[model samples]
Target chain A: MWCQSCREEYEERDAGTCKECYEEASETEEELKREIDDLKSKVAFLRLVSPLDLISTTDLLLHAAGSSSNANPNSSPSTALPCTPAVPAHRAVLISRSPVFKAMLENEMEESRSGIIKIYDVSYDVLRSFVSYLYTAEVLLDEHMACELLILAEKYQVKHLKIFCEKFMTSKVNNENAIGNYAFAHRHNAKQLLEAALSLIMDNMATLTEREEYKELVEKDPRLVVEIYESYLTRQVNTAAKDSTLQP
Target chain B: MWCQSCREEYEERDAGTCKECYEEASETEEELKREIDDLKSKVAFLRLVSPLDLISTTDLLLHAAGSSSNANPNSSPSTALPCTPAVPAHRAVLISRSPVFKAMLENEMEESRSGIIKIYDVSYDVLRSFVSYLYTAEVLLDEHMACELLILAEKYQVKHLKIFCEKFMTSKVNNENAIGNYAFAHRHNAKQLLEAALSLIMDNMATLTEREEYKELVEKDPRLVVEIYESYLTRQVNTAAKDSTLQP
Candidate 1:
């Protein structure tokens, strides 16, 4: 028989759906694609013009308190970083995007009263990207950027951006960075990243004790290292059970 | 053979895809659904807290120019719209959502100076829905609301809301509303609604002359009435051409 989809000869035993089902599935796929296109346009339309693109209308300024600034709001906004500039933003946009910002602004926090916010332990570029994401729900994220943004997203309770960053970081997890990522994930409460990193760590268990990151992790956080070993033991026990059941 | 999708027996002649292709297609559908979920959350996250919910921080007021006010900005804001209250909005949000508002606010226009915009020839309810949509990209639309909002959307050049209203209006086009909707769509430059209305109008051409809307439209705008007849004539010509070719 000929397969309607691939238009190739196939054995009847190897057949999948019937023609009616196939036609219905194709229609469903097309409808789903149309929905996706509609949603994409909606997202684009709903996106606010990023304040980074329009500085003249700004109502607030965000300074990145880099390491050298000692994370002090009292330090000059420009002097906070290695010549890092303050990111101009609108109060309404910041309030709309983050509940933390909403509370800060609406409750008359010092940041709101002063019309400036100082984000500690973030670089100028990351701070800028973070603010840009608030308005646009978009950012071009590398692994490093994803990690940095995830921390900021977490601190601000920006769940959508945190999930986006975690997805990216999970996809980039590998043997080389699994332990470090696993430790970072544990600290940041990233469940998916933790799971992915742990799976990679277990798959490369033979060299887990040898890596410099692993050694550093053991010295700094022995509990997380023990949890990895515990997970590996559980995996072994589950495998043995599956093997025993297959023997029947 | 068994149909994998329906779990029913089918003849080889009715086969669709091979098992491998079926599995791949199922996976693709799942991935598309996951993507849709992600986009939905992104939309939700980006949605602003409607100013109606928290009116204190509002920076601008919009008064609907109801019929009594004669579309005058000088009248008392409340007295303009049958005791309709002004719609509070943030200037930043208004500027971001509409280029017309951006120009009015950014170019030192009178509306910018007064921080009050009086929208002409619209009721208070319609004006409120319009401003709410600007914040949330959402609205509950009945036929009348859809039509009213479409006009407001087009006048303000809110393309997203206009398209949204057009889609709703198009879906509601029927034998009863076709002629009226056609005229409305044509006036608003709503191509999709115009086509849908035109198609419905053609489908009921035998009864078109009897409809009151058809006569009123002919009296109101003879050019649009002539265009509808011309379109119906073109459709007839095309059908006749196809029939003649098929006979060979």
Candidate 2:
């Protein structure tokens, strides 16, 4: 009989679905594609123009803290951050996007009063990308940028950006980076990344002990290393139990 | 043969896709659903908190024009327009979402100077919904609200909101309101709504001339009526030609 979808002859044993079911599947596929298109348009609509792109509309400025030595540390904020150019932002955008920013700006805080929010423990480039992501929900991520932004996202409690960074890191996980990523994920509370990294580490457990990163992890974060071994042992026990049940 | 998908026995003639093709299609469907999920999260992340919802973060005030008494005409913006409570907004959000607002606010315009933008010919509720849609890309749209917002969107060059309102209005097109929607769509340059309304109008041409809306449309805009007739004639000619071609 001819397969309705590809219009090619197939053996009776190689049948997929009945004609009615096939038609229903095709309809469902079409509906799903339509929904994707609608969702894409919504995303485009909802994405606000990054304040950094606008020349003159910024209501707040974010300075990368520790950019340089403050010559006159007691001076006004505008004069204090003398090295790195600030990542200009809007107050409304900041407060709306990050709960950390919301609390910092809404209260009678120094950042709110001065209109110059100094983001600490972050580089100028990463700070800019973080602010831009808040507006557009987009970023060009390499492994390094993803890790940095994930840390910042975690600090600021931006769940969406944290998930985005975690997904990227998870996808980039390999045998070489698995232990390191596993440690990072544990520190950041990234459950998905932790699972992915742990799984990768488990698959190469024979060589894991010899890897330099694994040694470093064992030294720096023995608790995380212990957790990984625990997970591996649990998986092994689960497999052994299943294999034993087959003896019946 | 046993159908792989419903696990039902089927006759040879009722065969659908081959097993390989079925699996590929299933994978494509899963990929599409995953894409939809990603786009949805992007949209959620990009959506800003409406300034109205957050107290004391607003930097701009959008007042619905012609609400009532302007009480103290020359009063400060904080005290001006005593009748209608202004829909508070953020300048950055307004500029990013609408080019019209950007141009009005970025330059040393009157609205920018006073920080009170008077949206003329719009009611308080519609203006509020319009502002809310800019921030969130969402609003509970009914026919009247959609029409009002469509006009506002067009005037402000918010293409996303315009398309959204047009889609809503088009879906609502029917025999009863086809003529009215057609006219509104024409005025607003809403192509989708215009086509939907025009198609409905064409389908009901037998009673078109007798309708009160048709009579009013003819009196108000004879050109639009002429265009409708032209479209109906063109459709009839095309149908006749196609029917004749099929006869062979």
Candidate 2 Cα errors over 4 Å, as ranges = A67-82, B67-82
Task: Give the docking tier of candidate 2.
Answer: medium
How does each model score on lDDT?
0.87, 0.87
TM-score of each: 0.94, 0.92
Model 2 agreement with the true structure over A1-248: per-residue lDDT tens digits: 88888988988778889898899899999999889888888888777787866647677888877534444343356655637788988887778888999999889999899888887767789998999899889999999999999999998999999999999999999988888898888889999999999999999999988999988887888888898889989999999999999996
- DockQ values of all predictions: 0.68, 0.70
Share of reference contacts kept by candidate 1: 0.63
Cα TM-score of candidate 2 = 0.92
lDDT of 1 at B53: 64
True contacts kept of each: 0.63, 0.79
Interface RMSD for model 1 amounts to 1.4
List, residue by residue over A44-90, the lDDT tens digit for candidate 1.
87888878656766778898876543545546566543456789988
